[model samples]
Target: MTAAPHRPPGAPTADGTEIEGRLDEAVRAVRAPDAVFALSQDGRRTVRCGGTAPPPPVPRDRLRYELGSASKPYTGLLLAELVRSGVVCGADPAVVHLGPGRPHPRRSAITLTHLITHTSGLPPLPRDFYRQGLPHWSTNPYAGYPAERVVRAFLRSRPAHRPGTRWRYSNFGASVLGHALAAATATPWEELLTERILEPLGLAATALAPAGRPDTDATGHRADGTTPVPPLLIGGFQAAGAVRATPHDLLSFLEAHLRPDGTPLDGALRTVQRPVLRRGLGHRHVHTLTWFRHPTDHGPMYFHAGATSGQQAFLGFRPDTATALAAVSTRRHTGRDAFVATAYGLLASLPPLDRE
Candidate 1:
């Protein structure tokens, strides 16, 4: 349970009121048990919360929700930071830091850029994932797949296409990238992320599962809104989908990306936004190192959405409008759920504001 709210939903303004109403409608539309909507515009922020009781008036900042694949962007940023700091280069082979293994013939072609851009030709998950995850498939599939297992599986992986020639989303590739970064720095991914990104950004409420404050963790629920699901523990596949945080902390993260000029990771922040690959029909969709780049009247909208067995999150920002959004729900995503579309629509609805 959360504490009492210090302020009403959203900020005390016309725009704030609108945000509150929109968020309420969005949450209800999806039948989310609990949800939070956070927006940061030119550094100003508004937050709205809703769902079943303890009710919509519950404190917005205390609850931490699983971020799922949205964690990839953080891994992407770490890669960029390492590159910018000369710790590694985007062109470096992923196998260089993946520890000793019989190198794949195509290993040299799969660079950090390919891995982060989803051009590595790796499958969506490790070859052995289903075998290991079968029992826990519905609740928490990645729970027991350790790093050694992941490494062994990767060494045996045979992609149908050559690396960097195809754009295929791969949790395996992302997870390996996380392992590669950890290997390169001789530090665990969680610690490296905390020291390099989270701590610097003052994101005290963000961390890997079973860490941070347990009391603030949000309960994940199925579509029924009655059945609760256990926390998702991704084990070695953590980098692919294990990060969690309060809406306030996630909004701060987007704000940093929206305005990265003076930060310690400014170089890396800017690096993640530079278009890296273009795909989709006629090559219309664009991907940056960390986010999906979609053209809008207001420059480009960079965003990512992720979900676990029982929670969903959407993160997006438009630098031209100086706006960022972080929306999250405790309910698992269903095909018909409007949570993501609604969040994207809300951000898209905001007009471009004058920038300095």
Candidate 2:
């Protein structure tokens, strides 16, 4: 709705415009009713466009979109804190914490790193998760499922691959990692996130709001683009993708990732951004603890996207250039190609990396 701040000296605006133009084209092509886009370089050279909803005169701050899987990095940060405090080991197998009572023997070998990198060999979702019907999965798949059920489902199923052997992008793995972090720290998952990640960073707007909040929540639209759905609440899987944040708060979070110095979790942030697995085509697919890395002519960039019943969002940063971009769409467009293209395009438009 508001224009982003002006670009600082020595930053490349031409490239930034090219990327923004591509995103604008995408929004137009999708005919999306509501969307928000924000870009920043070292917290300056920032720009934003679009609004909280489609047309017709409702102007609101662009903070109501659901952050979807982008919440993983926050979960990863909490896990990192546990590691820093010596309460948990990044490489420790899940079995070590869940204990012998847990069902899956394969899980015995799955490490925190595996969960963070999506290489834990877990399924994207539980097999019987759909038995409850489409509304359940579509609106709030995990809302009714309890943590005990998650442990049971995990133990009953076998790993899709050997631990740490491949990347399959499992939301289930992240949920398990969240539980494990809480277990190791002797704190509730939400409280652990608040105390360690949110409070320290002063991210007051970021958190899993319970069912109702009056502050500008975005409504998810159906494919036909008419129906509006309530925000999906994944009960036990809160850690996997349950965060609601504004673009400004998200930018603050991304800033910490891009520039971790002076942060409480700098060591953990460093670990989270370090590439662990190569995925996608050409093995150019780079992945760190929770963030996905994109190889660019400028340098290695990191990003992650989130989606839910009603929202889609993306965050990306070029470490070499200290540039970051974040975007949120109230409507879920089927595939992620546009989001990826936008991020890559934006990064490409930046000035060449300075080889120091």
Candidate 3:
């Protein structure tokens, strides 16, 4: 459905041609306001697509997109590094770092592992978050959240289920973990990530919270695709859902996860992808750090998808084939499904690995 391509549709490239074609048609198929995609295979070889149609690609490396909860894996990777350095262990309860006082054991029993895997039984958000944040739905929802308030919320609330008992996505849990990691290191979360993960990995373009570089950021589209949505700042809970980066930055990140050599965090990267919890019926899939394992005809894929108020992002890698893909779109709600389908379709188009 894309504005007709001059090249024959689905022309061959080193990257899967059929998938690339679908990637093009998909944008027109769903009529996205704007989107970008990147794929990597065999560690270094990379292919990227931008624009609503195909040719005259936008600058993939400089056009920034809000990563949303796609940022969680970065946090997970940092936790993996801390584990390697013996700075913190996943099994250790998160309360070890909360300051000013200790929380009651019943309320503070959640561990770093529980937080990373979404098994802490905390709700998708803290109860107070929406109560206080809804007024800012069109502005910065988390503009005023602070460390003291976060600790107070944890200490005062009761877990929906016992820690590590069941899976429930919790932005609150991740924020707590991020805060704890920051405290243990005696550095702010953004600075801690920069020194330990972003800098060491050489990902200079990735932007966490408190970083405002509008010159490079993309404009988000609302459901109608007419009015533009302003940039969102995740404030104190940034580690849970606020990260912005270019498609090129994500391509480098995917390569690091699949092939960790020549990188400083090789061991931690490998560990971050290992499955820890068998979730869902028949245990057909597992949760690894912040990644989700879903069955596909080719094999099991470990991936994560994120949505902010105005943006959507999908990042996935076939662990068996070491093929990775990242797709980001400027619109949210229905637009999310558009490119999510594009990304998964691309993955399905990948030829299965030839096992000896």
Per-candidate Cα RMSD to the true structure, in Å, reads: 6.2, 5.0, 6.5
Model 1 root mean square deviation, Cα atoms: 6.2
For 1-356, candidate 1 gives per-residue lDDT tens digits of: 22221222332323655656766677676668788888787677777787763643336457888999999998899889888889988898877877446656665467777877888888998767888798886688898898878877766777668998888899988988888888889998889989988998889989788443436778778877768888888888978888899899999889888778678888888888998888889887999999998887536889999998888999999876677889998888887888899889878777533232
lDDT of each: 0.80, 0.71, 0.74
RMSD score of candidate 2 (Å): 5.0
True-structure lDDT of candidate 3: 0.74
Task: Name the lDDT value of residue 90 in candidate 3.
Answer: 91
Per residue, candidate 2 scores C-alpha lDDT tens digits across 107-132 of: 77899888878888898887877676
| Model 3 RMSD in angstroms | 6.5
| Backbone atom clashes (below 3 Å) for every candidate | 0, 7, 0
Off by over 4 Å in 3: 1-16, 44-61, 100-103, 210-214, 352-356
